[model samples]
Target: MKVVKRLIGQRCLGIEINARGELMGLQVLVDKKDNVVLGEELTGMNEIQAFLDEHPLTPIALSVSSDEIIYSRTDQQLDDQSMSDLLRQEVPSFDPEDFLICYLDGFYGFARKEAISEHTSALSAYADQVVLLGFGPIPAYNLALTLREETSDRLTVGSYQFDLNDTDVQEITPQDLEVGGLTVAAHQVPAFLVAIGYFQGGLGMMGYPFAKNDENLWYGMLLNKLWKPVLFSILALLMVNSALFLHFNSLNQELNEQSVLMQNLSDRRATLASYIEQNRQIARLGERESAFAIISDQIGATVPAAVTMEQLVLSPQSADRRAESAYQKEKVLLQGITTDLKAFSLWVNRLEGMPWVSRVASQKLTETNGVTRFELALIRHVEES
Candidate 1:
């Protein structure tokens, strides 16, 4: 014999299979997130499997029975008569006692508004969560209140009201709020906000089934799958980037310190050079002053009383050791004339033999009517006596 499963309303639907893999029954669940079901049916399993294979159902947990499969659809576009017809066609030969049927028509137009409302009210007694999905303003809004009132303390209803006139879904009201109970907190807004946010940004919404019994896929399964790894990777990259930035900053600081040190060294070198040049200039000036003083003293000491100098000139020569030794000694040239030749010759001998003087040379003596004229060159020792 073929097994059967049946489900009622737009809640989550599931099938329960026996140990032999034969279909036992079907459960129509109200709470999709928690895996809570409203009602179930038992019928032929083989026929239900064949029907499901032909018209694929959304993947969800199921509660199977002896001979039936139970399920529900939230898409309100399916009309009541059409839904009834489809169920008949799907389970062609099912016993009335073995079949249970229910549906949610919140998304349907105003034509099936009464029928959908009646069905929702009837199912609220047993269902754990009832969802009202719709586009219009009036019927959808009305259904929201009705689900809340009917479910009361027993069940929670999530009203997903899509505004057909407006391009976006304006507001989502949780079922727990309308019944004066503790609603899902605002922190839970992120997941719902993200889903709606994507819809607003032009990405369509895709539903994934989550089972309450299965701990892994329960809370924000779809969101966790997509965002957890990505968030972790980004955090890790930011940490690595921060470390690298700090390393480069340290290196730059070190380079700046080295640059300052080099500049300081260069400044010290330039200062030393300036000091050396100044010292050389001071030494040269001192030597020049000493030489002038010595020459003045010698000229005074060698002057004779009868030989008055007519003109005296002193000129300095280059101090080249090699040239001075090879040729003649460098001296200061003194040009002059005197009235007496003998007196001038005596003065020349005294100037040549002076202690500070190295040597003295004279041009040939010339006497013109008792006026003796001659030039004398005196070489002074550069070293101290």
Candidate 2:
């Protein structure tokens, strides 16, 4: 056996090991100030025994693999009976009132029965944490009953039971409680602690699924393990979604309001347009009234005593009419005495020369009952000046 030593003060200690059982490393626990506290090593029982022997007075502690410590001598046999026999040989002797012992295993063989019976006398002296590995139907059932009596208040067994027959090594089952309030088979108490970051190595090496059987309980534990961060994430997502929904809803409402406003504006614009058109028509009617008045005054002033106005007509220019003729001519018919063609011509010329009249022409001249009548045309100007 090779021995390595490092002096360190009080602190939590850790050890690492490789697959091959060899002492490969050693270190002293150091703080930020480079002060040493605990010592660590990757070594076996020989080194541990030596260290303990040398530091008999000092409070020395050794961290061991849960599996390795419990099943150290039985690795080659692999059978429950053989492993039980090995445990009987290797397990430390117990002293009642000073120690307490509890076994966790899937089954018990002959050796387990002997070990349990022998250790029962000093079970109280054993540490709170003790476990056995392997599975058997008779052993499990028997152990369940025994644990009920032994660990009634301070300890429990198989409260959470893993199926010893399960090869997948993933299945776990919670133990059903009997008349007592104690949970003897619930593996969750230990496994849950591990998942929640309470326990790290040794007996806490198992993951959630391997330690719990109830799917809901398993999931609950997992969620609880990650509860803080998961809860925060869910809350953040809900807040973001709510904000987005509110924003879109507000935008929709605003759009609807704008649409209504635009519709009202459009209706008002249409009404205003109609009013403007009506006003335009009214202005045009007023201008036409003023033009008619001027034409009436000019016609009355231009007509001679020999000519009598029979009918006068005014109308808008026609599309088919010559542009100049349309703007400059108004049809007029006269029925009165005119001495001769010369007199008719003179009256026509005078009417044409009037400020508000033009384009005078005589289309007919007839003598009847010793009176001369003529039909003429004249143009009315829009503005008097």
Best by TM-score: 2
User: For residues 111-159, what per-residue lDDT tens digits would candidate 1 score against the true structure?
Assistant: 1233323333322222222121222222223333345545442232233
Top model number, lDDT = 1
Q: 317-364, model 2: which lDDT tens digit per residue? A: 556676534633344333455766676688677777776555554467
Q: What are the per-model numbers of colliding residue pairs? A: 40, 24
Question: How high is the CA lDDT of each candidate model?
Answer: 0.43, 0.40
Task: Point out the worst 10-residue segment of candidate 1 by lDDT.
Answer: 1-10
